[model samples]
Target: MYQGIRIAGFGGQGVISAGILLAQAGVEDKKNASWLPSYGPEMRGGTANCSVVISDGEVYTPIVSAPDTVIIMNEPSLPKFEPLLKKGGLMIINSSLINSRPTRTDITVVCVPCNKIAEELGMDRIANLVALGAFIKKTGAVTLTSVEHAMKKVYKRAKPEMLELNKKALQAGYDAVK
Candidate 1:
C-alpha cells in the first residue's frame, strides 16, 4: 500500500515532529518511508508542513503534491492543502483551531477538536500528537505499537515525564476518533 500524508499547521505546533514520528513508525514496521519538511521564516507562528510517503515499495521522491491523507491543524493550512488532497482522500481536521469545514464532497472528513482535547488532557502542546493518533488510527498506515516504539526511541532524550504525557496524548487522539 502507498500512503502519502501531509500534516500542516503553524510553527511550534509539532507539525514537523509529527511527520518525523510517522516516518519513524513506518521504518520501525519495516516499510519504506520518506519525510520532507518545510516552514516559513517565522519559527513559532509561521506556516509549517511536512510530507510523508509510506509504502511497501520504493519511494522515489519525498514530495507529495496530492496527498491521500491530510491532517490540517489550522485555518491557513485548510485553504492551502485541501485542494491538493486526492479525490476520496482522508482529511483529518483540527476543529478546535479551524472553524470552517471543507466544501468538497469527494473526500472523507474527520473532525477532531485536537486542541480542545489536548487541553482537557492538561497539555495543549500535545495536540499534534493527538492529530497524529487520529491519522494513524484512521489510515492504518502505521500501527499504534510502531508509533509507541518510535516515541520511546525518539523522545528518550526528552523529559521522563513528557514521554508518558505524549503517549497519553497519542492514545487520547486515537480514542477520540473512535
Candidate 2:
C-alpha cells in the first residue's frame, strides 16, 4: 500500500508535527516512509505544511507533487491544497476552522470539528492528532496502534499524562469519522 499525504495549516497548529507522527507511525508499522516539512519564516501563525509518503514497498521520493490525501487544518489551507489532491483521493477538513467546502466531486471528503474535539479533550494543540485519527480511520493508511506507539518516539519529552491525553484525542477523532 502507498499513500502520499499532505497536512497543512498555519504554524502553531501542529501541521508539521502531525506529518512527523504519521511517518513515524508508518515506520512503526514496518513500512517505508518519508516526511518533508515547509513553513513560512514567520513561524507561529504563518503557513506550514508537510508531505508524508508511506509505502509497503520503496518510497521513490519525499516530495509529494500530487497527494493521495490532503488534511486541511485551517481555512487558508483548504484552497491551497485541495487542488493538489489526485482524483478519487481523500480530503480531510478541519471544519472547526474552515467555513467553506470543497467543490470537487471526484474526491471523498470527511469534515471533522478538529479544534472543537481537541478542546473537548482538554487541549487545542492536539487537533492535528484528531485530524490524523480521522485520516487513519478513513484511509487505514496506518494502524491506530502504530500511531500510539509512535507517539512515544516523537514526543520523547512528553509526560505520561500528555501522552494519554493525545491518545484520547486520537481515539475521539477516529470514532468521529463513523
lDDT of 2 by residue, 48-72 (tens): 8999999999998999989999999
Q: Put down candidate 1 lDDT per residue, 35-69, tens digits, no spaces.
A: 99986573568679999999999999999999999
Q: Write down the lDDT that model 1 would get.
A: 0.92
RMSD of 1: 1.2
Each prediction's whole-model lDDT (CA) = 0.92, 0.94
Per-model TM values vs. the true structure: 0.96, 0.97
Clashes of each: 0, 0
